[model samples]
Target: MSAAQRLHQYLRDARRRRSVDLALTLLPWLAPVALLIARWQGATPAWIALLVGLCLIGAIAWRHGSRLDTPWLIRRLNALRTDMDDSADLLFAREEGLRGLQRLQQAWLRQRIETAPTTELRPAWSRRRALVSLLLAALALAAVALWPAAPTSAALDRLSPSPQIAAAPGQPRLVQQALRIDSPAYTALPPRNEPSLEGRVAEGARLRWTLRFQPQPDAVALVFHDGQRLALSRAGEDWSAQRVMTKSLLYRIEATAAPQAQTRRLYRIDVTPDRAPQLRVLEPDRGLSLMTPGQKAWPLAFEASDDYGLAGNARLRITLAQGSGENITFREQFVSVRGSGGARLKRYQHRLDLAALGFAVGDDLIVQLAVDDNRAPKPQSALSPSLILRWPADLGSEATGIEGMVKTTLPAYFRSQRQIIIDAEALIAQRRKLDGEHFLKRSDEIGVDQRLLRLRYGQFLGEEAEGEPKLPTSDSEQTPDDAHPAEAGASAKTEAHDDHDDHGHAPDAKPAVFGEEGSVLEQYGHTHDHAEAATLLDPQTRKLLKSALDEMWQSELHLRQGHPQQALPYAYKALAFIKQVQQASRIYLARVGPELPPIDETRRLSGEREGLARRGDELRAATASDPTLTALWRELEPGAGGTASASIDYAALERWLREHDERVPDPLAFAAALAALRDQPECASCRAQLRGLLWPLLNRPAASVRPRDGGDASDRRYFDALQQARP
Candidate 1:
C-alpha cells in the first residue's frame, strides 16, 4: 500500500480510532501531563489557565467531535505490541531502513520527518534529555500529590416530615403546623379592612374558623384544617404538612390563646389514620323523611355505625316532639330492627298507620343516635342515619282540601268622560278622609271581607252553569251497593287486608274490584272524576253554596260588630251552606246551630212569604229587622248579663214574630221586651253577646280594635269564648 493510503487507513480505524486517531491520539496525555506539572507547583495562574484551556478545548470538542485516540497511549501500547514475540513479523524495512541506509530512508520518510533533516549520533545528549524529562515528570507527580482534592457534593436540601401528635378528646385530629408569621393576617374580602395572615394554610374553615387579632394565636399550634389537608408549615402562608398517607384522615383546627384580644393568625395540619386515630360523625348523603297523619304509610327504619369497634353504646332514640301528641301514624312496633351484614347493621323499623301521624311528609324526625367507643383513649362519633323513613304520600297522609281583592276609588284621567267624573269624586273623598297610603292600609285589614262575601255569593249565585256538559254516569259516582241493601262485605272505602288480586299481582296496590249489583263499584265503576258527579252538594250541583258562604261571612261581620241580633239571619243564611257545601260543613253547622254563636237576629223567626218560610237573605233580613230578632239577639248576646230574662224574652219574641199579624200591632210588645233587656240578669259574656247586636244592626263603619287601657280583657274574653265554642 502507498504510504498515504496506510496513514488514511490508520486514521479511519473505527473501534480502534479512539486509541489511534491523530490529534486526539496526541493531545490527552500531553494536556493531563501539563496540568499535573502546573498543579504540583501550586500555580494558581497556571491552574486557572489550564482550566480555561480545558474548558475551551471541551467546548470545541463538544461543538465538533470527541475522539479519545491518545497518540502517546497508542505509541506505548504499539511499542509493547511490537516487542511481543508473537507480533514482531509485521514490520522490518521501516525501522531498519531508517536506522541504517540514511539516504533511501530519508528520501522515503522526509515528508513525515519535516522538522529534522538529519540525526546526529549523541548518546550523552539522549541521556541528558531523558534525565530532564524524568525530572519534569517527578516534579509534576509531586505537585499533583500536594494539591487539594476536589470538595465532595451534597444531597438535596428539603424539610423532613415528623410523626403525628396525639389528639385531644372529642377532636378529629389536633394537627399542629408551624406557620411562617413574618407579617400579621388581614382579610382580603369585606369587611376587608382587617389584619391578614402571612402564612395560613387554609384561609379559613367553614364552621370553626378562629383567626385571632390582638394577641395572635400560638405560632405553631392548631395549625390549620380544611376538609382534606391540615397544612402545618408555610410556603408564604401554606401550612400543610408534607403529603400524608393513610386510609382515612381527620383534621382539627382552632386558634391558640384565642380569648384575650388575639391577632389574626392561621394554621393547618394533616392526620393519617395509621399514625393517629381520628373520629368523625358518619353523615348521610340524604335526610330523613317521615309520614304525615292520615296518609298511607310504610315501614320506617333507622340505623347507625362506626369504624373503630363499638363506637361504644351507639343507640337510637326517638322523640315524639313537644306538639305532636299521639299522632303516630303507624300500626306496628315503634322501632323494630334486623341484623345482618359483616358489621352489626341494625335497622329499627315500624309499620305505620296511615291515619294518625299528622307530620308533614318532607319533615324529618330528629331521631338521634349517639355513639361512644370506650377505648383506653375514649373516642366518640356524632354519626346518625338520616333516613327518609316513610311511605309515599299516596299511601300515607289522607289529605283534606277545601275547594279554594282590592279596590280604591280614583279620579277619572279624562274630564270629558262620565266615568272619569266618578273616579275624581272618589279621589276627592279619599283625599279628604285619608291618603292612598292610609286608605290602602285600611284596605289591608278592614271591610274587604264584604267584597269577599259579594264575590263568594255571586259565585254561588251562578247556576251550575246551565247546560254545561255533565260527567258521564259511572259506578265511581254512585253506590251500587246502596241499591242492593244486602251486600255481605265492608264498604270499599274502608281498607281491608288478605284480599286477592284480580290483576294477578298483589292486593296491596289498591286494585279496583268488580262491582256488586248495587255497590259503589257498580255505581261508580267508570267515573274517574267521581268528585264532580258524586259530590251532589258541591258547587257543580248547588250554586247556592257560594251565597250561603257569603251569608256566613256577613254573619261573622255582624257578630264582630256586636249586632248579634242582626247576625242571626246571616247565621241562618250561613247555616244554608251547611248541606250546600259538604257533609262536614253540614255536621259542623248542625252542632253549632243548636244555639246561635252569640249573634244577632238568630232568635228571630222567619215570617211567612204568602205560604212558605222565607229563605236566604230576604228571610235573614226580615228576621234581623224584627223586634223578635232583636229579642233573640238579646238572648244569644245578652246585654247587662240579662240571659235569664233574655231567654224568656227571646222565646216570646220568636212566637210573636212567627204570628206575623201586622194587624196585631204587637211588634211593640217585642220592642218592649228588647227595651227591658237591662232588667233581666245574665252572665257578662252572654250580656256582652246581647249588646253585640247593636253595631251590625246599625251598619256602623268597621274599625280596628286597638289594645285598650284594661289590658285586652274584652278581646281576651271574646277570643276565649270563640275558642271554647269551636274546638
Candidate 2:
C-alpha cells in the first residue's frame, strides 16, 4: 500500500482508540447522573436524563474527531519525524496531478515511511482520566443510594399551604401564629417550634398555640372536628391555648367578630402513640430444654425494647413444679433483674443453678420475663413466652408374667382409685386440725381425683366419657340400670319382643306344644338380644363392675360438696369392688383383623405427590363499598355536573366519618378535604383534592378472568418455534 493509504489506516486505528477512551471517561457519568435525577424526579425523568447525557457525549466525540483529522496527523508526523523533510503532505497529494518535484518527493517520503516505525502516529489512551471518572461516579452513586428520606411532617409542611391570614373587611384577620411542642420526659426529645399549624407530635406532648389578629375580636376559640371547643385565653392582643396531645384530630379557629365566622381551612395535629415493651428470649435456643447428666447450670439471655424509656427493673417469674401425680406441689417466686444498655433497649443475662432452686428429678422449672415501659399512671407491660427446664423422670420397665403374657403397669403420675380413697381418709383425719374452709377445699380436691379415677375405669367398660358427672339425690334413689343405660335399654327391648310372638298370637294364647317356646325364632331368626352374653365377662362380674362405678359416682358427689367424711364410706366400698373385679380370673381379648403389607420406608416422609393434584384456594374478593363514600366521590368527581354550591348531606357524611375514622389512613386530612369542598363546592382544586382522598377508600369491582392452563413440554416447544419464526 502507498504511504497515504497506510497513513489513512493509521488514522483510522487512532480514531477508534480515542473513541473508546472517550466512552470510558464519559459514559460512566451516565449512571450517577441518572440516579441523582431519579431521586429528584422519577423513573421517567431519569430516562430523559440518560438520553440527554448520551447526546452530549456524542457531540463531544464529534468535536474531538474533527480535531484529529488527516491535516492534524500530517502536522504531527512532520514535527516528530524530521527525516521525512516536512514532505508528509506530498504522500497524501494525488500523484498524477502533482508537479515533478512533488511526485519525486512523494515517492521518496513513501519509501522512508515504510522503513520508519508508524507506532508514533497512534493516540495515547486516557487511562488516568477514565479511572478518575469511574471513581467519582461510584462515590456519587453511593452517596445518593445512602441518602436518608426527609421526615413526613417536613414534607407535609412544604406541600400544605399555610393558613391564610387575610380576611374580609371588618372580619378578624389572623396577623401572626406560632405553635410550640414540648415532648414528655420519657421520650428525651427536645422541644421544637412548628412553622405551620398542621404537624405531628409525640403522645402526651404539651402543645401551645399563640395567635394575633389585625383587629381585636370579641372572643376566639379552637373548634375541633369531634365537637370539642377550647376557648383561648385572651391576653392583650394575642390569644393563647395549651393542651396535651393525646390523639390525632382536626381543628379550626373561630372568632366572634361583628359577624361570627370560622376559618375555612381545618388544621391537623397528629399524635404518635408510645408503643409497649417487647421482650425476646435469646438463649437456650428452644423453649423446652431437658437436663443432661452432670449439667448444673442453665444460662438464659433476654432482650427488651420500648419506643420510649423502659422501667428500672424487670420481673423474672419462676414457677417450680415438684412431686408427681395428684399431689404435685407448685411454688412461684418473682425475682427482680437489672438490665444493661440504653433506656430504649436493654439486655438481661441470668444463670440458674439447678441444685440451688431445689429442683429434683421429675421436676419442672418454668421461667418468664415481664417488662414494662415508662408510660405514666399505667405503664404498658409485656411477658415473654414461658421456657421450661425439666429433669425427666425414669420410665420403669414393663412387667411380664408366664406364657408370654405382658402385664401393663400404670404410670406413677396417674392417680388410682386407691389413691383417691387414701387422700379422702387423710383429709378426714385432719378435719379437727384444719379450719372449715381449708377442710372443705382439701375435700373438694380429693373429689376431683376420685372423679378422674372413675372415668379411667369407665373407658374399659365402653362408656362415653362425659365432662361432668351426674349426681343422684341419694344412694337409695340410684339403681344399676341408671348407671348402665345401654344395658337397660337392651333388656327393655328384649322383654317387649318376648311379649309379642312371631305368630302374632294373643298374650294368653296356648303354645302348640310344651317344648315349642321360641321354636319359631330358633328355626327362622337369630338371637343376639341377650345382654348378659354380649361381653366375655360373666354376668355376676359385670354386675359387680357396674356397682363399683355407681359407688364411685356417689363418692365424687359427696366429696365435691365438701363432705369428705360422708364420702369415705362410699369411696372405701368402690375400692373393695374394684379389687374384687381385678382378682377375678379369665380376661378375654378381641379378635384381630388380617395383617396388611409393610409400608415402603423410602417413600415414608419423602413428600412425594406423584399422582396427586394441587387444590387451588377459593379466594373471595372484597367488593363491598360504603354508600356514603361512593356518593361523595361521585359528587366530587370532575364533570359530574354538580354545581359548586350544590347541597351535600353533611350530617350523614359526618356520621360515616365518625364511624370509620380508624380505618381512614389520615382522618385529619380526610376531614380537611371534606371541609374544603363544603366551603367552596365550585372550586376545581377543592373537588380534585376531595376526589383524590376518596378514590383509595372506594372498593373496586372484582374482575372475572379465566385462569390460563399450564401446557405440556410438546405444547411449549411448539410455541417456542412459532416465536422464533416470527418477523
Name the candidate that leads on lDDT. Answer: 2
Which prediction has the highest TM-score against the true structure? 2
Q: lDDT for each of the candidates?
A: 0.38, 0.76
Q: Evaluate model 2: give its lDDT.
A: 0.76
RMSD of 1: 36.3
Instruction: Determine which window of 10 residues in candidate 1 has minimal summed lDDT.
Output: 184-193
Model 2 C-alpha lDDT per residue in residues 288-378, reported as the tens digit of each score: 9999999899888999999888987989999999976578899999888889899999998888887889988889999999999988878
Q: What is every candidate's alpha-carbon RMSD to the true fold?
A: 36.3, 32.4
Residue 612 of model 1, lDDT score: 55
lDDT of 1: 0.38
Please report how far candidate 1 places residue 648 from its true position, in Å. 99
